[model samples]
Target: MNTTDIIGTIGVSLILIAYFLNIFSLIKKDGNLFYILNIFGGAIACFSSYLIRFWPFVILEGTWAVISVVALLKSIKKPQD
Candidate 1:
């Protein structure tokens, strides 16, 4: 596989691990850093797919990444539960 493929694979793997970590509380739900990292990593992975010229992945990841970051930001501005 090419370098792009490897990089994208690593990025995707990180996103999945982060997602499951968040889901299982392996990372604390209230941790801002964790959330930011998750969003950032996911965005990077998704965006990389776009950079590689994959239209469908670009759309899927683009939408999800934006939504994740926006929601996280909004949550930050509001008081915690």
Candidate 2:
């Protein structure tokens, strides 16, 4: 449809895919791919939320994106099991 819709859809799709994969044991939560999906998904979702002037979702997705980034860094620094 619109640019906003397209972006939001992609973001949400990534998040959902990650969740689905995790639930089915296809991917580990601590894996880089998981964090990557969340980082991009949350960031894109946050941007779309901001575009729509939705403060709640913007805050939520922004926090999610930031936490994902931190988690990714920590995961990288630490040894993987």
Candidate 3:
């Protein structure tokens, strides 16, 4: 596979894994790991999409990455129980 394809695959895999973990109750939705996976995955996916000149996915993934980053920051600011 090409570099872009490989990158997109890995990015999508990371995102899907996070979703699967959440659905299976293996990880909390608000957990740092979940946001981390989403941020990285979304950023990678956004890059790949931009490389391909796919505006729709670029927007989608960009938004996803931004939201994940915000969530990550919020999680970090929260005091531990």
Candidate 4:
């Protein structure tokens, strides 16, 4: 596989890892690691989509990345107990 494919695979892997961990109760959905993985993975995936000029995935992953960033920011700003 080429570099873009490798990057997309890694990106998708990271996203799936986060989801799997969440489903198995290995990590909290609101945890920093979860959002971090999502943001990075989505960004990488979005970039890969852009490289291939795939508009559908570009929109999907771009929205995912943006939402993840917003969640991360909100989490950081939230008052801890």
Q: What are the runs in model 1 whose C-alpha is more than 4 Å off?
A: 28-31
TM-score of each: 0.74, 0.94, 0.95, 0.96
| Cα error of candidate 2 at position 15, Å | 0.5
Evaluated at residue 29, the lDDT of candidate 2 is 89
Residue pairs in candidate 2 whose N, alpha carbon or C atoms collide under 3 angstroms: none
What are the per-residue Cα lDDT tens digits for candidate 1 across 1-81? Answer: 887777677767766777788898888665665667667666777768877899888777667667778767877899866
* Full-model lDDT for every candidate: 0.73, 0.95, 0.95, 0.95
TM-score attained by model 3: 0.95
Weakest ten-residue segment in model 2 by summed lDDT:
72-81
lDDT at 26, model 4:
95
lDDT of 2 by residue, 1-81 (tens): 899999999998999999999999999988999999999999999999999999999999999999999999999999756
RMSD, every candidate, angstroms: 2.2, 1.0, 0.8, 0.6
| Winning model by TM-score | 4
lDDT by residue for model 4 over 1-81, one digit each (tens)? Answer: 999999999888999999999999999999989999999999999999999999999999999989999999999999998
What tens digits encode model 3's per-residue C-alpha lDDT throughout 1-81? 899999999888989999999999999999999999999999999999999999999999989999999999999999999
lDDT of 4: 0.95
RMSD of 1: 2.2
Off by over 4 Å in 3: none
